[model samples]
Target: ELEALADPMRKDVSVVRKRIDVVNKELKPLGTNVQKKEKEYKDALDAFNEKNKEKVQLINKLVELVGESERLRMKKLEELSKSVDSMQ
Candidate 1:
């Protein structure tokens, strides 16, 4: 009777160890998934930063172009004023 009781207890311990091993195996995949998601988030942030940088550069170029256009218009007005004065 004692041996029979020991056999059941031994089997129970063996079953518990197998379940623990399965849980350990599952943890590796969970860790991998977490790492993959973190990397994806970082990559997305980098892409956004690059896109914003391009936007800023284009805006600056547009501002410079507008300033140059104004300068040309002012020069034309001055030249027309001088021509009228000379004619009079």
Candidate 2:
């Protein structure tokens, strides 16, 4: 009777071990995939940051050029007004 009881328990333990092995095998590839995805994310983030920096620099230069052009145009207008007033 004891042997009969232990036989079923042994079979159950064997099935559990097989299931654990299958899960481990499935998990092994997932680990590598996770690492690969992490690397891809990091590379993408780095590229985005670099592009953002370049965009900011270009915007600053544009602002500077616009300010300089406005200053020159105002100076020219003032000079023309002074000459017109003298002539009148």
Off by over 4 Å in 1: 1-26
Off by over 4 Å in 2: 1-8
Tens-place lDDT per residue, model 2, 1-88, is: 8887768688788899999999999999999999999999999999999999999999999999999999999999999999999999
lDDT of 2 at 72: 100
Task: Give the per-residue lDDT digits (tens) of candidate 1, residues 1-88.
Answer: 8987768688788899999999999999999999999999999999999999999999999999999999999999999999999999
Evaluate residue 88 in candidate 2 and report its C-alpha lDDT on the 0 to 100 scale. Answer: 100
lDDT of 2 at 44: 100
Candidate 2: clashing pairs of residues: none
Clashing pairs in 1: none
Worst 10-residue lDDT window for candidate 1 reads: 3-12
